[model samples]
Target: MSKALDANNRRWSTLVWGSIPVVLLAGALTVDHIPGTDVRLTVPYAAEGPGPTFDTLGEVDGEPVVDIQGADTEDTGGHLNMTTVSVRTNMTLGQALGRWIATDDTIVPVEQILPPDLGEDEVREFNQQAFVASEASATVAAMHYLDRPTTVVVHDVVEGAASAGILHPADRITAIAGKEVSTPSEVQDAVRAKTPGESIEITVERDNEPHHETVELGENPHEAGQAMLGILMTSEPAGGVTVNYNLNDIGGPSAGMMFSLAVIDKLTPGALTGGTFVAGTGTIDDDGEVGPIGGITHKIRGAEEAGAELFLAPAGNCDAVKRVHTDHMTVAKVDNLPEAVAAMEDFAAGRDVPTC
Candidate 1:
């Protein structure tokens, strides 16, 4: 009788512990069966929770995750972990119900992740591509942040296009609207943010001298009504300084910030964390601008699981992060790479860490 009462008490304790997430997940639960007779019904929702993290400053499979060549590398210590979210999709009803009461992970419509229009493999491919692109951007971003020589030059300006004579071929594009740009995609993304006929200031270096042009955007030849600069730009990293990322099966651009931090740590003299464990997530650009990412809470939990002392969150996710309750980790809001580095420095020096 006592054993049975203890079991009942434990069950109720768990239910109370996870009651909030249970209530949250109950609404999104829907049937999306895969025609399997083994299970009663499969839920269409996907669960996203903490996934395995990697220390970018450390080794993976006996190789440094961030391998920098032709430069003096720092002998770094502690963790500069990049967090990931473990996703559970196409779950059976039994699994879904168990998860609701067992974990604090979030469940959402599967279509939000794996859209109906694309297959899982295709989506994975796109994610991997984004990861590669972000890695390239992070490499140059770190270089640019360190004031190393990097260039984003106009390969060609399309004839009769918006930037026809406004942007000359071989012109080294410096910044877009005062924001430093070191990649062609940043230039493209900046232009795409505006509509046709919108004017933008494009700073460039022609004949090794500073210049700026205010050019009116033109409609994209491919996507109607969208803005285009009509100038093809190419990025070149600092010569002989190559960065190679050596982790696999991890997809998405969310690791961009951590990767940049790793690169910066490696090239610089002192470790950013100063032997302190740190974990963070943000999509960073070649301009060192940090952007928000999904699964913030999940990544936070992952960082905590790895015993991280500090959590570096993007300023854009301040509202969301402020809602979370953490036990011991110090959460700091960083707007860009410089801010992130400063946060780490502050934490290392035993200073009062900033929070959202």
Candidate 2:
């Protein structure tokens, strides 16, 4: 019995000692470093951490975060903050290892944040464009929720299609077939109301003036027999209500929800945040629907650190939020603009806000 016990102990010791080298080798490979060498590899990983938070309801550098021009905006008090995630890419092996062990940041593949083929400049430009588009959608969604006027603007015109020369981008479609149209669906429904080769008159606002054009409809590129105008249109705020997002540093569609909330609060009577700190992120469409965004965990940490009372997350991201721990703030799931507003009001009223 004593010999058997000694043999078992020896085998266990050998196994434990053997795993140490294999574990070190795996760790070295994970950090892209060679064992017992000075050589370091360029790791295709990025470290993401909590970034700075900006209040959408306040001004940044003497400029309002949500600048609404040509309107008598109401007084807004409180904070509707937007959060961001800072990413460090193209890390050296030693730096990667340091970040992996020293910080609470997430280390992920660089391709998750940026493309390998495109440079940082190109990625920044693309993200800025997406941010601009999200701002437009946020403005339109706020206006729609407030029952304000919206016009359908031509986004693009396809070549070799009917109305290609007549309709141009940036032209706002005011009416179609002698009927008023304000949304993209309205325009499409009116066009499809007619058959192919049918001529219809369209009224467009171009360069601050109305222009009339009569063009025959063409068959839908995707549908077999449906009629199409061959132009893509999007609904936007009309009547000189211009919304300018002030942040030039932050890029991406994640700020859409906060932008929409700020617009609503500014155009309405009372404060939406009730003078308390509230931070959230999601991509909002023109219909007030909220979509999920990346980097929710880091954003949560930032918001909690900023002393936010409530954090609004997309409904789809509730599962992700559940994995993290928030000590000070409450997390509420929002599927649209109304839900976000309700969450804020409930928190302000000392009601029980929904948790992740």
Q: Specify the highest-TM-score model's number.
A: 2
Tell me the RMSD of model 1 versus the true structure: 9.9
lDDT over C-alpha atoms for residue 34 of model 2: 56
lDDT of 2 by residue, 80-131 (tens): 9999999998687667778999998999999988887888999999999899
> Candidate 1, which segments miss by more than 4 Å at Cα?
1-41, 153-234
- What does candidate 1's lDDT look like per residue over 298-333, in tens digits? 899889988999999999998889888889799999
Look at candidate 1 and tell me the lDDT of residue 57: 91
- Candidate 1 at residue 93, lDDT? 66
Query: CA lDDT of 273 in candidate 1?
Result: 90
**TM-score for candidate 2, residues paired by index:** 0.86
Q: Which parts of model 2 have CA positions greater than 4 angstroms off?
A: 1-40
| Span of 10 residues, lowest total lDDT, candidate 1 | 27-36
